[model samples]
Target: MEHANTAQLGRGPVTSSDLRRRQNGRLASIGEPLPIGMRGADAGGREGRSEAPLPLILRRVHPLILLSTVLMCLATGARAQQSSTATYSVTFQGNWTTASTPGGVVGGAHFTTLIGAVHNDQVTFWESGGTATAGVERVAELGSTGTFKSEINANSNAISVIEQSVSGGGTGSATFNVTVTSDHPRVTLLSMIGPSPDWFVGVSGRSLLNTQGNWQSPIQVDLFPYDAGTEDGTEFSLSNPATSPQGVITSIRGTGKFSNVRMARLTFTLQSAIPPPTPPPPPPGGGGFGGGGGAPRTSAPSAPRNLTAVGGDGEVVLTWEPPLRDGGADITDYEYRVDR
Candidate 1:
């Protein structure tokens, strides 16, 4: 006699046992479905039963449902492989004093408002052999960042703009923070040397990522003077004739008044990193054939490890390692309140 739930196909009713046998045979041919009742039985197997009801459950699962589950898992794996974000404290230490460059350091020597952006290889704000844009020209020649700031904001490839300056005489320092991601890891910064024609100091397209695809910290770069090639003046004076046709950007070191000494230096120190967001939990009640509750909830990451602080003349630097347990999700960010 045919069971009430036995499915009919073609000439006769197909019993659950017969369906199971056919499914198992097909799976076993592909190196799946260990003998029934064994651990790690293939997807078609059911444990602790001579002939189980899983065959009915499998029959009820639509092909589309199976495809959706597979796609979700693939997406989750891709999210887990995303890159982390990094924040750095950039310090610009100016050394363009009369003592350092006795050849032509002027009395009112100072640095204009520093302006630049963090971007990728797709766009370049300024480079050694490249011609300066209208924005770069204004920043280098007139110490104005209005045009440059607008230019940076207009570029889709640019990530963030940096604007800071040092006061007092030439030997001052300015510090600011900037964030970077794996996609846009390069930094370009420029600041004009005041009382000059079109001489500026900066780094162009400097990358912070290392060979292992991680942020490198505490990197220091010497800043040299570069001529915007827009003016023909060689001395520290503002009244100079413009280069009639304009020329390509070039280093001013060992040429005329400027010497080979570094005008300033920039230090990039890692502050914190925000890892990619955790893949969303699997949908409620697992998508598998037999519905069950979703996976257990995850907890927040543990506190950062071995945090240490070092005090400087007017600043304090803090560093720490990632938590031992990430709580099954990448850390998004770290927040700390200062008591002082």
Candidate 2:
């Protein structure tokens, strides 16, 4: 045992042999953890061998063992944080009846489990103008997963990771594994349904407030089908792109058709000590960009108030004071998306 002047202390000559002997004594303690770096001088002569050549003798770990240990930890972390910034293979397991095309729901099913993927700020769900990437399009059109992996790689941000899975609608559950960067740990399961095009099961920025490592069980999320707005409307591969015509604005865009897929408002909140997003002050007024856009629509900026995620009913409600940018429209609508 060694003691120092309220600073650092360590045992003598902690060589590999010493570490191995200590580890052999206990099953739980196997690998050599990065030891505390300290020297006798810093400790004010904590040990009698203050003048030893290698004062701080951390047991040199065997290269293979060290690599294995690091890999094991990385894998554990990947699974622990399956939700956050990685790709999770989502499989549609439940009864899917919604029309994958623009047609209405044909059967009793209301878009059950549709395989989907999630990431931070950037999204895998479809968006306006852009067609569903080949992966998403294939999933929507043919129930195939072959190309989705490539598309996910092409569409992800440097911080994103991908995990995926799918299953045929039969007797058992279609299982999939969630893959992601070993860091971001707040995301959860992503789902998708087939009846609709560009529609899907999306679980965006989730909260890891309580969960750290192991799961507590599964929670039922809305799995709202976001109209990636990709491919106009969700369409299937036709002998011609005309036969399955998928780009009709029905419920999702509500722009062309005005139906307002109105699947219910979904809100995802990413809470972290994130650096406050710097919003460029309205472009220089006076005709250059923000200049000619009128008097910059005088309004109050939106002050973040309270954000609530109501369980069971499945709704994320955010309430805030009117924005400084309010143009007096009574704040008709508010849009919320994951902020990475």
Task: For each candidate, give its TM-score against the true structure.
Answer: 0.60, 0.32
Candidate 1 lDDT score at position 312:
37
Backbone collisions counted per model: 0, 35
- The lDDT values for all models are 0.64, 0.33
RMSD for all candidates, in order, please. Answer: 18.3, 24.9
Residue 233 in model 2: shift from native, Å? 6.7
Best by lDDT: 1
Per-residue lDDT of model 1, residues 192-214, tens digit only: 98878998999998999998888
User: Which stretches in model 1 have alpha-carbon errors above 4 Å?
Assistant: 1-81, 280-340
| lDDT by residue (tens digit), candidate 2, 1-340 | 1111110113333232232111222211113442222111111111111111121222333323322221000000000111323233333343232322234443322333333343444453444344555565665444555576555556544243444343344111444444433344345333344444445544545533334543222433443344543344433221323224444212343332213333322223322223223333444423111122222333332432333222122211222333343342223222221110
